[model samples]
Target: MIICELKNNQRTDALVSELVDIWEDSVRATHSFLTHADIETIKLYVPHAIKAVPHLFVARENTGSIHGFLGISGQKIEMLFIATQYRGHGLGKKLIQETMSLYPITDVVVNEQNQQAIGFYEHMGFEVYDRSAIDEHGGTFPILFMRKP
Candidate 1:
C-alpha cells in the first residue's frame, strides 16, 4: 500500500463517492451515537469539505484503490477515516506521520464518547486539554480537545 497526497484534479466525482463510502462506514463503526439520519446529513457536506480542505491525503493499495484518507486544515486534523476492514493496520498511523512531516500539527479533537478514538489519539502522544459540552455541529455528543504533549 502507498500513502500519498491527493492533488486537485485527482479528486474526481467517483473518488469523492468512494471516500464518502469509507467515511460513512468508518463513522458507523465508531460513532454509535449518530443516527442514520445524521449520517445522511453529514454525507451531504462531505464532498464540499473534501475539496476545500487545504491538505488531503489517501492511502491506497497497489491497484490505486483508496482504503483510508486524512484531511487537514492548517495544522489541525479536520478529518481522518479508515475503512472498517483497514482499521487495525498501520494506515492511520502512517497518514498521521505523513501529515506531521508536512505540517506542524499539534491539535485535534475527538468525540469524547468515542473511547477508542480518544485512546488512539492518546496513544499517539496527544493529551486531552479541554472538553466541550457539544460538538461543532451543535450535537449533544461532547468533544475532547487534545494537543500533542
Candidate 2:
C-alpha cells in the first residue's frame, strides 16, 4: 500500500462528501456538537485546508486508486476516512500515524456515544482532558477534549 499526499483532484470531491456523511451520521447517532449547517461549513473548508497541507495522505493500491485519506490542521486531526472496502487493512491506523508525524495532534471528539471510536482514539494514546457544559446549542451533552501528551 502506498500512502501518497492528498491531491487536488476529482477524487477529493467524493472523499469530502464521504467524510461529511460520516461526520453527520456520527452526530445523529451521538447527537454531538454539530448541526447540518456546521457540517456544510466544514465541507467548504476542506479544499482550502487540503491545498495548504502536504501531510494529508491518500492511501492507494499498486494500481493507484484512492482508498482513503488523512487530514490534519492546527493541533487537530480534521478527518480520517477509509473506504468501506479497504477497512481493516490498517489504512486508518496508517493515516493517524502519518498525520502525527507532521504535527502534535490534540484530537477532540465531542458527544461521543460511539464506544468504538472512543476505543480507537484511546488505543492511539490520547487521554481525556475536559468535558462540556450545558448550553442552548451545546446541550447537556458532554464534549470530551483529548490530547496525546
Candidate 3:
C-alpha cells in the first residue's frame, strides 16, 4: 500500500465520488447507530466535504485502487475513512501516522457511539477532552472531541 497527499487539482468529481463511496461503506460498517435514512441524508454532503477539505490523503494498493483516505484542516482531522474490506489492516493507522509526519494534527472529533473508533484513537495516544450532545449537523448522535497530548 502507498499513502500520498492529493493536490487540490486532483480533487476531481470522479475522485470525490469514489471517496464518498468509501465513506458510505465505512460508515455503514461502523456507524450502526445511524439509521438508513440518516446515512442517506449525510451522504448528500460528503462529496462537497471531500472536495472542500483543506488537505486530502489517500492510501492505495500498488494497483492504484484507493482503500482509505484522510482529510485534515488546520490542526484537526476533518475526516478519515477506510473501505470496509480494508479495516483491521492498519490502513487507518498508517494514514494518521503519515499525516502527523507532515502536519501537527492535534484534534479529531469522533462519533461517541463508535466505540471502536474511540478505542483506536485512544490507542493512538489521543484522549477525549470534550463532548457534544449533538453532532455538527445538529443530529442526535453524540460527538467526542479528542486531543493528542
Q: Which stretches of model 2 miss by more than 4 angstroms?
A: 7-55, 133-142
Colliding residue pairs in candidate 2:
none
What would the C-alpha RMSD of candidate 3 be, to one decimal place? Answer: 0.7
Question: Model 2: which ten-residue window has the lowest total lDDT?
Answer: 23-32
Pairs that collide, model 1: none
State how far residue 32 of model 1 sits from its true place (Å).
Answer: 0.8
Quick one: best TM-score, which candidate?
A: 3
Candidate ranking under lDDT, highest first, comes to 3, 1, 2
lDDT of 3 by residue, 79-98 (tens): 99999999998999999999
Say which candidate scores most in lDDT.
Answer: 3
Which runs in model 3 stand beyond 4 Å of their true positions? none
TM-score of each: 0.96, 0.63, 0.98
Better of 2 and 3 by lDDT: 3
TM-score-superior candidate, 1 or 2 = 1
Off by over 4 Å in 1: none
